[model samples]
Target: MVLAIAGIFIVFCSVILIAVSDRHPDATEGISSVPISIISPFQDAVTGSITFITGIWRHYFYLVSTAKENDELKKMLSQAVEKKNQCIEIELSNQRLRKFLDFQKTRMAQTVSAEVIGKDPSPWSKTVIIDKGRSDGIRKGCPVVVPDGITGQVVSVSTYYSKVLLIIDRNSAVDALVQRSRARGIIRGMSAEDCTFHYVLRKNDIRVGDEVISSGIDGVYPKGLRIGYVSGVIRRNSGIFQEVDVTPHVDFEKLEEVIVFITPAEYEFEMP
Candidate 1:
């Protein structure tokens, strides 16, 4: 009974549609009994509506996914950059600590620690000023050294400031000995990168890479402090001495801080 009722309802709606189409013949122009032209338009409208709604949903989903990916990538890049800077800072601190330990082991006679606060700022002068001054027991002719070796001498001093004449200065001289061979010579500041060792007997045993250190005989610099490594040796033709060039241990271009050995007050000079 239910099927019979539904079939009757469908047939009744179809008849009404056919009567309406008959009243408007253009709506059924190509069909003989049914309005196919009207049927086509309705079917096309339903499909187009579905496609428009699906396109809108697809665009919305794409926008949301792209925003999330962009944020994630930016955060990753930020973390990488931060780690790079941290690594560089750690490496620099490690190098400084190693230098400090080396100085402690040497136990220089007596020492003053100071930071370089200023430079000549002129290409003509390689001078640097240290924070330690005369008030801090610093004076002219005081020896200065870094972990690797000698830097210069304190040439001028005020109550609150001291000027260091770098090993590259023209007027600086130091008595030094070759570490491996125990040969003695007078080293003078010759240039920005090295010094000249004079009064070396041509027959003396010297070679490249020999370490140079303070001789302590002058009572100015304590003996056995490193100065530089030998880089050049020139034998003169029938001359009394040979010329030697040494590369300083400390790099002035990268100089930062230094230690000065101050002899105990009782450590006075003995006249010959």
Candidate 2:
């Protein structure tokens, strides 16, 4: 009975030792897989979340830098545009000055430059004030001209300023002749932009685009100075004279500078 009891105890201990020992490879692997399965997903999730957050932060900074650079480029563009405009203005001013100088050199008469400073307040009188007066050799009846054509004549004078009566004033008249036919007529201003060529004989040949020039008979304007061009002509059977409409060469509204021909005392006295 004693031997049987000892044998049963030995068997029980052997079974416990097998259960506790890591003897079988498959068994060991199975035991280790449970913790790995549970922990691997958590590690992957943590790594993924970290990567996502880092990517978002990097993109936000990139956007901010791009926007700042765009604003800087826009400011540079605005500055370049302003500079270009200034350059264009300077070029235009230079061109005008060159033209004025060329005109001065070509003319035979002595002239002084004058700037337009003001306009006549009276609606009926089409006149402009110049920056020259008696001090600058400007006097009454002095002819004012531009590169295009005659503009006006000085009507009043002061110490430092002079008033010019534009040829378009109603009270203004000029002796002119048609360059094509040498037809003589009196150009009378009826409005600010309109003039009538009166006393032109109906038999005289008058056509549109015919250049009208000073006849030098008035003793005011020089001979052959451009006055206007014939725009229209009207002939009537009952009237002895033909009516001709003329368009002036000078644009009074755009006048900025003028050349005043300084007439001698004899010429000024001869003018009526």
Candidate 3:
């Protein structure tokens, strides 16, 4: 009895649908319109969500690529700046070497160039070590000088290096004369940066700003070589000698290269 009732209901619904279609004659189109309208909003929503996600992915990848490129550019710029600084240092070194060369050509003595490699370890000694040594014909008592003025004399030598005793050492002294007054005095090292003019009489016409040069009477330093300028002059009515301070022309702290006047040689050569 149940099966017979279900079959009757299904048949009855089908008959009613057929009757409605027959009356409208375009019922299939009209019936589909309502469902299409309802499903169209859902389809459009899915498509918009997909497009938004795709745009975000593309923008994210673009930003990543741009960041990588910016990093590369920054690295390149840093390397360029370092190279420029190196070039400037090289140019300045070349200028200094050229000036040294000119001084060597004008000097009458035989000279060999040497680079300063080290300084005296003892605080009491004002000395520097040069790269040239016995193998290069450098010997003890060789006078060391630079373009500006006299530096010192070589005191010790090895096969590959030599030690120079700077004029600013306490034990060092030079016979000097005032260029303007022709007054004779001894230039003695009192400190690392200063020297004293000794044995000058109080009646001498020595004044500040006078240029002192080597007298060449000692037969060590050549004649007319600059020693220093008078920085201070103290006259005393009681003492036989006046107190005078001389500031050296060469700044020892900034010394890099020097010329060594080697004995028995009369040629100029650059330091390696």
Candidate 4:
């Protein structure tokens, strides 16, 4: 009875081992559902980790590329703006040259063209610098002029530049004639943008709005070149001569270029 019982127990253990080893995957999953559930969660976690890693790499690459492009675009924009400003400056310079050329055509005197390069250093001196020099025939006391009227005189000359004493300078003087009465007088500079016509003799003849032109008597400037106009006549002083306040024909503050007039005697004789 003991031997038979041992043999049945051995057979039962064999059957249990075969049943566990040969079980279907579905049958195993049904038996212990936790492992299947763990597999799904592990697969999801692995897939999510891969997706997060890929997304981080893609965004980082995109940002790096975008920043590089933005820097390049900014450089291009700055260059374009600089080019635009340069074009505008060139256009304006061309326009000013055109007007300066027109002024050259009207005068019979030999001309030396010069650009205004500087303004008065001293507050009391109304002077400007011209680009012309001694080599260009610009000299001290030579009259300077523009299309509208006389500007000033060459006060000092150097190798590359000349100083012009403007019409409004305190030391400036011009022989001017009254356009209406044909009267002659000396106009003296008093302040910036102001002068006085001396030797008007009578105050009534020199009224407001009277024009003044070079008389040619002084031999410094040619006749009929405009100097300025009488803005007001001060007769209140009741002196022998009237004090006529004059505004200069040219605005010295905005002066750009001028022509140094070569006398007719010098130009006509020098022609070969």
Candidate 5:
């Protein structure tokens, strides 16, 4: 009975060991496979989760870097555009200055270069303030001019600035003669854009489009300086003088720079 019981016990133990051990068709060693089999699904799930999180982090970092690069590129483009505009403005200014230099060579008298800094707000008067004054040799009655034609004469002066009475001012007048027929007339300001030729006789042979130039008798402007052009002419039998309308060559509203002629000492105080 004891021998039979021992054999039975040994058979039961062998069966249990075979159930837990690895099944091999040719290998001799037996490795436990139950633990690994149970844990494989969990391991795969953990690895997949880590891969997904790492991918999302990398994508977010790439997006942030791209946005920063785009901002920097936009700023660079804006700066380039601003610099281009500045270059264009500088070129335009240089062109204007060149014309002034060319005009300066034609003048026989000394001149002071000045910039128009302000204008009179009074509607009854047309005048501009220049940056040069007595300290710069500018004086009252000094003839102011531009490249186009005669501008005005200085009527007031300070140490560093001067006021120029434009030809369009109601109080302004110049002794002018028609360039075509040598007809003499007094160019008087009538409005902001028009001047009237007074003392022009009806038989003076004046006509529209005739240029009026200074006769130098006014003692303010130089001889042959352009004052304006005759725009209209009317004949009347009752009056000795004809109604003549003149238009000045200078564009008063667009005045930016001027040249003040440094006249002789005797002509400084002779205001026109």
Candidate 6:
């Protein structure tokens, strides 16, 4: 009812204003002034409503545009971070390869470089799988070494991969000599980080910090290649041999790339 009355009032006011204006062309005086004053307030309210609705519509679209732009910027930033990480990895790999090249130039034996791909899951056995296999001249009993020192020996071979028994495994052994006093001993794997130097006479002048190297008497590792250093020594009063602990030069946890000697079993070459 209120809406109908308001519509009727608007029509009535329009007709009166038109009729009054037509009667007196040049007169703005008596009747025309009353109707104009009555309708002015409603006109202003309608104009204000239209303006408010238009402002809300424009602001909604602007917020949507800003959200889309923010999403695109986030995506671009993620891609940039991924590319930077890849570049860093490539540089590190190149550095390791350079070190391998220097090692090959200084060594006398023929060797094939292989990447470590997998590790033995059994905690009792310290072994790692390499990318090289029988096709790459990697055979059982092939010695594996890194730039620092001996790593292990290849014990199992497949077409494209081989499993190496690391020097830390209990079954591994190498003939070693103390670099300082020429004390002869057999280095046997005792644990993940240490080995035992066996058969060293108690009378020998061996002490902690003495460097150990391969003797090449066993015909496996080359002569004078660095193995480890003596970390501890225990002498018994009655026993002729002393108990010695050795720490290998190679860090097995950080092992990545290794060199496998392809030379025959009897042809062990010396390292400079």
lDDT of 4 by residue, 1-272 (tens): 99999999999988886687456323442333343234434444554576678879888868969888989999999999999999999978865775655532233678888777566658887887676767787766789999879898876666556668888888778999989988778888876678988887864487788889999888789888998888998776566777788887887777876888855322222211
Which regions of candidate 3 are displaced past 4 Å?
1-107, 264-272
- lDDT tens string, model 1, 83-197? 9899999878865775655532223267899877666757766777776766789866788889988888876665555678887776678988999988899988865678899
* Candidate 2 wrong stretches, greater than 4 Å: 1-107, 264-272
Clashes of each: 0, 0, 0, 0, 0, 0
| Tens-digit lDDT track of model 3 for 249-271 | 99999887899989633435444
Write one digit per residue (lDDT tens) for candidate 2, span 1-272.
99999999999988876776535423443454354344444544564576578878877768968788889999999999999999999978875775655533223577999877666668887987776777788777888989888887887666666778888988788999999899998988875697899999999999999999988788788888999999998898888899899999999888878999996323221111
* Residue pairs of candidate 6 with colliding backbone atoms: none
Candidate 5 is scored at a TM of 0.58
The residue ranges of model 1 lying beyond 4 angstroms of the native Cα positions read 1-108, 264-272
Single out the weakest 10-residue window by summed lDDT for candidate 6.
28-37
* TM-score of each predicted structure versus truth: 0.57, 0.58, 0.57, 0.57, 0.58, 0.58
32, model 2: CA deviation in Å? 99
Clashing pairs in 2: none
- Candidate 6 C-alpha lDDT tens digits along 38-100: 443344455457657877887776896878888999999899999999989987887577565
List candidate 5 stretches off by more than 4 Å. 1-107, 264-272
Clashes of 2: 0
- Model 1: per-residue Cα lDDT at residue 128: 79
Quickly count the clashes in candidate 3.
0
Number of the candidate with higher TM-score, 1 or 5: 5
lDDT of each: 0.76, 0.79, 0.80, 0.75, 0.77, 0.80
The sequence of per-residue lDDT tens digits that candidate 5 reaches over residues 1-272 is 99899999999988766664435311322222233234433544554576578878977868969788889999998999999999999878765675655533222588888877666767888987776777899877899989778898987666666778888887788888999999988888865698999999888898799999988788888878887888999998788889999999988888878989986323222112
Off by over 4 Å in 4: 1-107, 264-272
Cα displacement (Å) at residue 60, model 2: 40
